[model samples]
Target: MDDRPNPIDRNLLGIYLNDHLAGATLGVDRARTLADAESERDPALADAVRPIAEEIAEDRAELLKIMRRLEVPVRRYKIVAGRLAERAGRLKANGRLVSRSPLSPMLELELLRLGVEGKAAGWRTLRRLADADTRLDPGQLDNLLERAHRQLDTLEQLRLRQVSTTFQESGDRPVHQESHA
Candidate 1:
């Protein structure tokens, strides 16, 4: 039996993994930011976010381990790009005075939710391929999937509450008098 692994496998996996790492990195930052911002508005929500952020960070480390096992080198450029992209996300237009804008946290929560959804799909894909590729474990992927689901739920609930309180009845503008200056 030809034991040579498919060359396509490593290339595809490396690309996907690099992208996955980007989302995980962004998710880690966004989750922590959300938790910190919510501390003033909703202490309980902030408290709930700390553990999720910690877990996601741990999962990112696990991704590095998986990449190492597959002999796939991490594209450091992608990591740098992801960091830049997240910094750009922080610069989004959010009407504000001098203090931190409410839009900041709300937009971040939405991004975090989207990132978790992406992570869930990535885990499911890995789980399906685990049988063919010995580098991955289905059980570990399942655990990640479950965690992603929980994180998604939390973000959705928080996003809705934030939307309700931040937006006006018109739902187009901030409830607070925005400084157009």
Candidate 2:
């Protein structure tokens, strides 16, 4: 009996992979930018994010490799749009006009977290295909999934820390008011 699964629709698979490639491009750019910007102000954060940024870049390469194995041609326009979108994200108001706002890191971290989560889902999707597709590596996808989980944890911790500092003065706590009749 044949063990190979039925072939997937190459056209649809190509489109899906290309869209993820665009997202990966934006994610790599944003991760590097966040790491560099945090270096001066938050060395610890820079240290934590730097590795994740490198990993994200590596993950992007891996995605490209997978696309090549699947014979999916990258859509250049999508890559360009991803680049432009990343730049445009910088224009959002962050409660500061000139200098970097404390809110900026918070927002960036949240975005990065969301991207990683999406990437994780992509990895899982490929892993599912790996069961019948010899070209897809389930073990590699598992490793990628684990790394994404770690990155999510780190980003969440950093984001929570930023929330405390950005929303409250050093020693201040939220005050409660009693209801009046």
Please, what is the whole-model Cα lDDT of each candidate in the order they appear?
A: 0.79, 0.87
Candidate 1: tens digits of C-alpha lDDT, residues 52-73 = 8998899899888877887889
**Candidate with best TM-score:** 2
Error of 1 at 163 (Å): 2.5
Candidate maximizing lDDT? 2
Q: C-alpha displacement of 72 in model 1, angstroms?
A: 1.5
Model 2 lDDT, residue 89, Cα? 95
**C-alpha lDDT of candidate 2 relative to the true structure:** 0.87
> Among all windows of ten consecutive residues in candidate 2, which has the lowest summed lDDT?
170-179
TM-score of 2: 0.88
**TM-score per model over all chains:** 0.82, 0.88
Tens digit per residue, CA lDDT, model 2, 1-181? 9877877888988888888889999999999999888777777778888898999999999999999998889999999998999999988888778877767778899999999999999998889888767898888899999999999998999898878766776358433333465
lDDT of 1 at 152: 87
